[model samples]
Target: QEAKLWLPSAVPSVSRLTVCSVPVVETEIKLRQYRCFESLASLRHYLSLWTRIVLAQRAKPRSHHWSTRSQKAFSSVRERADDTAERYRRDRQAILELRGRGDWEQRLQVLRNEDVLSADPGLL
Candidate 1:
């Protein structure tokens, strides 16, 4: 019998915003110059827009938008995101605290290895 890894689903919903029609290349200076916006709010807005564009690319990611390897990488990311969100409702604060420590990847690695710990572990 072939044992399948209990991995997260392959497909997760992605935001629809990509730069297929528009050329979206970045040079370091260009990015740094743009990052120098006078107001943080304006910079944040640009970042937000860029995020949407990237999300769109992920939603419909393909060789047209990115390479096959990149698309696979994005899918892994999207699956992890879904897993985190789905688990957060009950363990939100604990998750946030662990994330804040900058050891989030390490902690989540344990989750990837261990059994789930539902917090009403006491009565059981």
Candidate 2:
């Protein structure tokens, strides 16, 4: 049949043979190209949970005595969380700037050549 004859050509044999597993690093980097709504939604949900926790903890009566160490620990935790969120924001911005309608396949291939994904550390 005509379909049978064309099927062989349609699926390039070389591409099949060359379909080796991508390195773990390259795999993660390339996966970022695909939009993930579920992850974004989950992140938003977690952020909301953290906000609620902060509010609830604030409403709770503090022990009559507050230790300096406890205050320092709480402050450190909040600062670390803020820093993490800022890093994600910057990373997203850097990725957008690097993309600028560029070809993902080409960009991925180039990235694989070096351990570094982008000159900008944000992509890391």
Candidate 3:
């Protein structure tokens, strides 16, 4: 009778349930592993993207054109400054000739008086 009970066909209900639950446990474990791998893949993608951006910023200009452009810009600015200074010098020379020996304030006062006297009295 004991040998008959020990046969595979006569296994206890508890052992049968344990055998059936094994596949469910294995499926859960596989699902967890898949989630972990997905998370790692996402992290790797972000890291690569960040690295690309940083490297692009750190990369130096490869051509001489950039330096040439900067030099041209500086020369143009210098030319403009020199032109403005020359124009100012010419204007100052003209003003000095017109004012003679008097300072600018005296010249301005005389000019203002002359303008008042020159205006037509009828217009006022």
Candidate 4:
């Protein structure tokens, strides 16, 4: 009788497996190459360059005219908002008027109850 042992010959290390299995596309490689910033100025320059490129792409003014229905809807919404604001202001003013009147009436009632002014008809 003979004892035999079978062992796997190719055992890939974690690092090697991860590195080889993932496909690195050209765009990713280019991005990785550009990611090295030696200083803050370099990073700022890179960002500004990209910003200018993006801005240049959108240099043309786009004409965006709203549809008639949309314009009407927006106008209605604005009118509704204005009306609500006006109503709020009017209600607030009315409430303040009522409060002022109530305070004035209370003071008048107190004065009348004390009969301080009634004693002197000249003060009335």
List model 4 lDDT by residue over 1-124, tens digit each.
9977311112233343344333332333233223321222342343344344334335643345434444455445445434433443343333333233454333222112222212223323
What's the best-to-worst order under TM-score?
A: 2, 3, 4, 1
Which residue pairs overlap in candidate 4's backbone?
A: none
Residues 2-46 of candidate 1 have per-residue lDDT tens digits of 987321121121311132111221232233223322222332343
Candidate closer to the true structure by lDDT (higher is better), 3 or 4: 3
Candidate number with greatest TM-score? 2
Local distance difference test values of all predictions, in order = 0.35, 0.40, 0.39, 0.34
lDDT of 3 at 36: 37
Considering every candidate listed, which one attains the maximal lDDT?
2
Question: What would the per-residue lDDT of candidate 3 be over residues 21-121, giving only the tens digit for each residue?
Answer: 64644443344334434533443443344344334334654457855765565455445434433443443343333333455434222222222221233
User: How many times do residue backbones clash in model 3?
Assistant: 0
Candidate 2's error at 117, in angstroms?
Answer: 30
Candidate 1 steric clashes:
1
Higher-TM-score candidate of 1 and 2: 2
Give the higher-lDDT candidate: 2 or 3.
2
Query: Candidate 2 — which pairs collide?
Result: none
Q: Quick one: how many clashes does candidate 2 have?
A: 0
The alpha-carbon lDDT assigned to residue 75 of candidate 3 equals 51
Return the clash pairs for model 1, or none: 17-56
Instruction: Give, for candidate 3, the lowest lDDT window spanning 10 residues.
Output: 110-119
Question: Cα RMSD (Å) per model?
Answer: 22.3, 14.3, 42.2, 34.6
